[model samples]
Target: MSDDLKEFESDFATLAKLAVQQSEEDVRLLLGRLVRKYRQRHPELAEQLNLSLKSIQTRSGSGALRRESLSEQAPGAGVPLDRDSRLELLKEFDDRGGMSVPLLPSGLLRQVESIIQERQARETLLARGLAPTRSAILVGPPGLGKTMSARWIASRLGKPLWVLDLTTVMSSMLGKTGANLRAALDYAKRHSAILLLDEIDSIAKRRSDESDIGELKRLVTVILQEVDHWPDTGLLLAATNHPELIDPALWRRFDAELRFSAPDTELTVQAVRRFLGPDTEALGQWIDTIATSLKGRSLSDVERAVTTLRRGHALRHAPDEELVSAMVGADLGMKSKVERLTLAVEMAKAGKHTHQEISRLTGVARDTIRKHAGPSPRRGRGMK
Candidate 1:
């Protein structure tokens, strides 16, 4: 027998035995999973089998069947599917596999989480004559956590993430882009997947731009219409670096409008501590100094800089002070660095450090300090 036939035989045998011995809950759960996988391999055959299975399941008097019924409602079961579907580049996957979730500020974290958490209570939301916020727009500078949050939602909801890659979705062929978007959204609705229209500003720009084609302007209206009618089960998320470019009407269409920014002090410190790992606890009180030095950088900047430092420190056997200096230097202005170094000299003198120790710590010789702060050196770089 072919491998496909062998696998089918094994699955069917297992399913058959489960039906005879397992409780209804166990049987229904396993049956749904079997059908889900079976649909991928033989959608037409699976659809036929699903109809027969549902007939038998209802006859057995199970009042509500979650997956067994929902799987049939998923895309392409009994419903006519488009032959010329233009959404080939769209990817579908579940979970981020424990990848790093960004440390967002509390306000923004709660905002993003509201949508994610509501998605879990979708049935409750719809049953009460309310719609769970289906669509959202994330506005932020590049390198913030907008994209990461989108993935995190998919993982949390345990739904396939349907990402619409604009480069592939946008086509020069007349009227094709709109069709592609509709088909993608339709798929998301049918599967209850998280649909991410990343970089949405590229198409949903304000209509007044003279350079933009009339069709490009019309796309904004089409997007808004789709959002208005988007289903409660599916989550529609749009991320953009420039929110100002999107049409104003489009702005109000989404239920949530979240603005993301670079990490503040607390979040930056958390990111630093996370990236530093065991080294953070080892540094004791000094970790706070490292966190303060990382204040102005984005989470990505800290990750890359610290990761590089780790590799260099391991290879070069550099001291912890080298890494600290690099992080602190990145956050300070050039003039600030000089001023701090000078201040360090004064601070050391005001304390117990010997002159030579102060010189080494400040990278300033005693004569250099006397020349500048002594009141005998030139008043300015060039002016006397």
Candidate 2:
């Protein structure tokens, strides 16, 4: 057997032996000490193992360390294994396994690297007398890469990203929501995983507007307290599309605010070139023109316009000018004459009215309207 496997086997044997002789408290104490020793000796291995050490101090019980058992009451029971637990502990030793590392695109790599360095610097500050900042808020419109950056950070830090599952975590049971959140926070703290709270504005909105202010206040209080006392070993990342709508108090908890604004003309062109190739040169110029025309539009808008243009081009086998015109017109807030026709077509497709009804309402051609409607999933379904 390999050295690592031999070592793990030896450790497991020792635990089993101790469990047989020692009291439950003694076994737990012994296990904790062994875990600490292992961590000190092989920090990297310990991290790879993803072992969580929780002290189970309760009334008298069996001293035996139950192997591969699942109990909600057991300390640190809900912590997920780094690998599938179906394989016996001994089998896991033979099976090579490792965590997947996330890859960030070249354009965003430097920014994510800087965030890691900033986190390290904060750790150094905490080593001295100064208190390090505990939280960060990533603000960006949809699909501008906020979530991607957060995932990259977690991977780089060798931490699991515990995405806050509001649906599962939120409970209608009286007083249970708060307790569940607290348990989750405690679990996060124990495991040293990055607690990523995406769409934070949904939960942390301004309390003044809430009809049930008490519940909102309590939830916010728990969040703030957790942020305040979060260990320096892990990072906390929160993201929001609507930063302005978030509570003002929520801003104070975060150490840094990273704003991912819409890409400039140059960046947008680069992104398009990267995603699509040199064949999209004319499309890129059109995009640059569109970007200039719509200064305040988001990256999402640019992407959607490009997707629609590509789809339409493929459907109609159209030339560059026709495709670009269709794309630009379909985009919101554009003043092109074709834009009105595109809007009417979209409204009609959405079940508002038929083409004849649309034409009667807006004085546009039913055939022309049908042309702009593009591929209809509803029509395909109907044909089927």
Candidate 3:
């Protein structure tokens, strides 16, 4: 038999297996390739297959393949790339087992958990003639684990996460921009992978803004349509630090909206403890003092500060009290007199430092610390 015939047989065998298993997506994808392959050599056969393919894509209901799934597969079935600069448009991360749930507030954590649970139980929803959440928008200030949360959701579902590399996807030639985005989205849908449009506000600006050009606005239209018809097999996530810049119409399309705020005092303490890692035990005495000082800050900032303290303690053999004191002292300079007094009282109550040390570090009077905290425990009680 000719090599072409052998190839045809193999393709037919795989298609038959996929059909028997009711893998509609795989069947659709294979039929598409066969249609193209036979187009020139056997135009009549190709025409028949093409007609059937179009019918399958446009068929309405729960099991139909999305129209965008008809998009040509990216070369070699790898991540999509810009044709001009060959820059990769989608960055792939397969963290099937390694990713951990990001540190988040209790309320925000529940929202994230629900998203994962819904995706895992997608079949149950389909049975009831309902669709699972196909898309969500993560809105908040930066450095608050929005991206990490996307990773965790994908990890829990046992799927690879494909993050859109906006730097590469945004083309200088505006026409190519839309094409690039569609190609990337189509590829993600084809593989049923989680696709995160990080910093979506960049391209999804308000359409009413008069300064924007026609092509840029067209990008928003492309995204709006994709979000509306996103397949149940894939999860689409968009994250933005500035939600206001996103078009109002685009915002309404997401199935859920997750808001991430700065960590509260209790959450900050938990973040500090987690970030301290192995040194959490060594610096256990100053956890409350550190948490109080770091309150109102983002979790990322807390992690950075804790990491620096851990490094100093490990490398320079710096005492935990001195490191914590220096950090708190630097922060104290920015605080008002009342704020400093409050923090000083907190430090005293922690009983990890004497009144003299707390007053010196926080610039509060020793007498005031004693009056507020009802006197320090003892000299030896504090870190030497």
Candidate 4:
């Protein structure tokens, strides 16, 4: 290892030793003092160090460490560890194997670093008498890694991330939906965990839209209030493909707004290589072409296209030429709702058929046929 890496390893070893010798409560006190001191002197290090502290707490506890331990610790009155002691403890514990924060790949590491910096700015703002906003809105098309980013944040911060499943929380009965949301939010708050409201626009959509029901409106209101009242110590992230559909109030409440847009040609090429593996050279070229063709498409669409192409190749028992031809045909046009709806209607009438068969009959792209015939029922018909 290089000199810097060797130094880091040594420091981490020392920190681990110190951490292992302390009781869980003692560690919390030590960490609390460390967090306060770090925030005062080197605020940039606070988020990363705080995350490590949380990780140590989680791993050291008998059960899961209560969120209250971090947020509701007795006001002042803990270990007398200062910045140097905390740093030494961190160095000792750096490699002791208890939920060490996963480092992002090199390309993404810079972005993660920027997020840490932004978090420090928010903390500084809060310290200066501004109300600290704990909510973040990660707006992106599907599969651009918005959810992954949220999980990464939780991992980096040594906090458990609770992904709110809309289906579980939404209810048909009056008042039940709001109640469910409140219960979930309270659980998250009490745990001091990261609450990820994935595809939030589905539940917290604009009230003015004709399709929205009164129950949804109440749910949105409750959600907005919860976001407004969120504890500064915890993180709340909401991710959506359709940000325009989100309620205005919710939009304004977020302290940080990040957009995970479609990957450019370079990123798409890298992703194709990452997913398809290096040996598939012809397949990679086909993906490049598809990526070019689907310029404005979401990451989900790119993945779907790749899967369809691979399946088509596999089922045909075809060589590279045939596989390339099939992929090229599918990549001819943009994915369209009308095309999908038409295929779904045709499939309903035709009964179950393979993608190629559906494509032949409906004159639609084979990829489109595959997508529409997925697990979901057709637009107007129930699955039999």
The pairs that clash in candidate 3 are none
Compared with the true structure, all predictions reach lDDT values of 0.64, 0.56, 0.78, 0.57
- lDDT, candidate 3, equals 0.78
Of 1 and 3, the candidate ranking higher by TM-score: 3
Better lDDT candidate (2, 3): 3
Off by over 4 Å in 2: 1-112, 120-133, 165-174, 204-211, 277-295, 312-316, 332-384
Q: What tens-digit string does per-residue lDDT give for candidate 1 at 1-384?
A: 498887676666655644553334445655666678779778987787677668767887765664322234455343222335433545654464555666888888898778877877754453344567889998988877787888888778765566776545554343566665666666555555578888888775433556557777667667888788765656788888888777788888989988888777778768878887766654433344545545566778777766766665667656665555554555444337576565444434333333443344345576765554442322221121
Question: Over 4 Å off in model 4, which ranges?
Answer: 1-113, 117-133, 204-217, 278-287, 310-316, 333-384
Tens digits of per-residue lDDT, candidate 2, 1-384, equal 497677666666655644553334335655666666678777875554334334253233434444221222364457532232221111001101233222234545565676677666753443343444456888878877776667667656544456664434442332465666676676666544467777777665434555657776787788888777665556677888888867778778887777777666556655554544444754544444344433345555555666666676567768765565455445534455565575556555554345664454344577787788843344321121
Model 3 over residues 1-384: C-alpha lDDT tens digits?
497787666666666655664546756866888898988887988898788777777763435454332123454456667888887788766677676568888889999999888888764554455667889999999899998999899878877688995655764456688888988887776666689998897775433556656877788888898898777678899999888888899999999999999888888888888988888787877787789988787888788888888888898766667787788877777789998888888778777777877776788899988888896777623353
Q: Which regions in candidate 1 have their CA more than 4 angstroms from the true location?
A: 1-88, 96-101, 171-175, 204-212, 278-286, 330-384
| lDDT-superior candidate, 1 or 2 | 1
How high is each candidate's TM-score?
0.64, 0.54, 0.76, 0.55
Residue-wise lDDT of candidate 4 within 37-128, one digit each (tens)? 56865587667778877787667664443544322445322311223222110001111123423223355546555665555564344334
Candidate 3, 242: how far from true, in Å?
0.8
Candidate 2 residue 44 Cα shift, in angstroms, is 24
- Mark the 10 consecutive residues where model 2 has the least summed lDDT: 87-96
Candidate 3 residue spans exceeding 4 A from truth: 1-23, 26-77, 204-211, 333-338, 371-374, 379-384
